[model samples]
Target: MKIDIVSVFPEYFDVLNLSLFGKAQAKGLIEVHAHNLRDWTHDVHHSVDDTPVGGGAGMVMKPAVWAECLDELLGLEPADATPDAAVDTATDTAAGKPVLIFPNPSAPLFTQRDATELSHADHLLFGCGRYEGYDARIPAYYRAQGVNVREYSIGDYVLNGGEVATSVMLEAITRLIPGFMGNPESIVEESYTGEGALLEHRQYTKPAQWRGLNVPDVLLSGDHGKVDRFRRDEALTRTNDIRPDLIEQLGCKALDKADRKTLMALGWEVSGEHPRRRGK
Candidate 1:
């Protein structure tokens, strides 16, 4: 996979050269290029932001600068056009188009499912916004050119800029790419993955008893069947207590009789495939 990141602080991504990412690059599994957004500026100051057209507290990034950078990177001609309603944002990456992403605090939260989908892309271009944010028209104009543009927020809170959010998303998406991880299976049963999408159960290593806290007896047992059952139940219990929203999202087909019984014991009402908190 090829990844292009546009940020004012291109040095922030130098760390990508260390650890597993560095290893991936060494093996030729992926390629990364971080470009300074200011490189696209033509002025002496190389300014990339300006005061909002309407009164605003912070400066908004300039669209012209962003457009020039993106147009060159995405291999497109500059055109004045409205976003096409027929443009499919979900087009398959195999179609040989690069996926364009922007990090925005107000956008929908990025998810593991999104990472899985983007991992298959042949090329990805990420624009990291600073100050208030890039002009909204930047993404709109790219979409009009039939580019697969996406905007996402890593979490509910705000950040000073998109650099950190882009890093977080890049890590998530790149790690899922084939040959990126030493053990690919390590990602399969993780939280927010797979059909059930439940939080992962707690894990313990050797020396089962640590600091007077003993590992679960089931895990220590040699019986794999019992161990699997124990982990599944723990996952269900943890997800219910910590994030009941995940329980509510669970489909009936995903839960078996034993799972239903466990949820019922925890004051959850099972209606069809969905589970609800009691008295809610």
Candidate 2:
């Protein structure tokens, strides 16, 4: 995979050379480049932002600067004469296409599922907006040109800039790429993964007893069947207790009789293929 990041603080991504991601790059599994967004500016100050047209509190990033940078990196002709048409249907087939991403605080939260989906793309271009955020027209114009443009927020909160969010998303997406991890199976049963998207079951290492707290006896037993059952139950219990929303998203088909009994005991009501929090 090829990743291009456009940020004012391109140095923030230098850490990518220090860990597992660095190893992946060394082995030629992924290629990454971070470019300064100001490099696309031609003025003496190389300014990339301006006061909002409607008089906003903070400066908004300039669309022209982003367009020039993106056009060059995405290998597309300038859209100067392009009409403001609806996004083309070709964007529906994103395989092998360059996906353009922007990190926005107000956008939908980025998810593990999105990471898994984007991991298949051959090239990824991330535009990290600063100040108030980029001109909305940037993404709209690119989409009109048939580009796969996406904007996401990492969480519910705001950030100083998109640099951190970009890093978080970059790691999430790249780690899912083939051969990125030393243990491929490590990601399989993680939280927010799998059909149920349940929070992962707790894990314990050797020295079963730690600081006077003992590991669950079931984990120590040689019976793999009992161990699996114990972990599944714990996972369901934890998810329901800590994140009932995940439980609500679970399909009835994903649960068997044993799972149903467990959830019912926890005050969940399963109706058809959807489970609800009882009264709701």
Which ranges in model 2 have alpha carbons more than 4 Å from their true place?
81-94
Off by over 4 Å in 1: none
TM-score of 1: 0.96
**For model 2, what is the C-alpha lDDT against the true structure?**
0.89
Q: Global lDDT for candidate 1?
A: 0.89
lDDT of 2 by residue, 194-263 (tens): 6779999999998998899999999999999999889889999999889989998999987888899999
lDDT of 1 at 243: 84
Residue 111 CA error for candidate 2 (Å)?
Answer: 0.9
Candidate 1 lDDT, tens digit per residue, 1-280? 9999999999999999999999999999889999999999999999999999979799999999999999999888888876554267676565777999999998988999898888898999999999989899988888888888899999989898898998899899999988989999999889999776999999999898889999989888899999988988899999988988888888877788889898999888887658888898
RMSD of each candidate?
Answer: 1.3, 1.8
On a 0 to 100 scale, what is the lDDT of residue 40 in model 1?
97
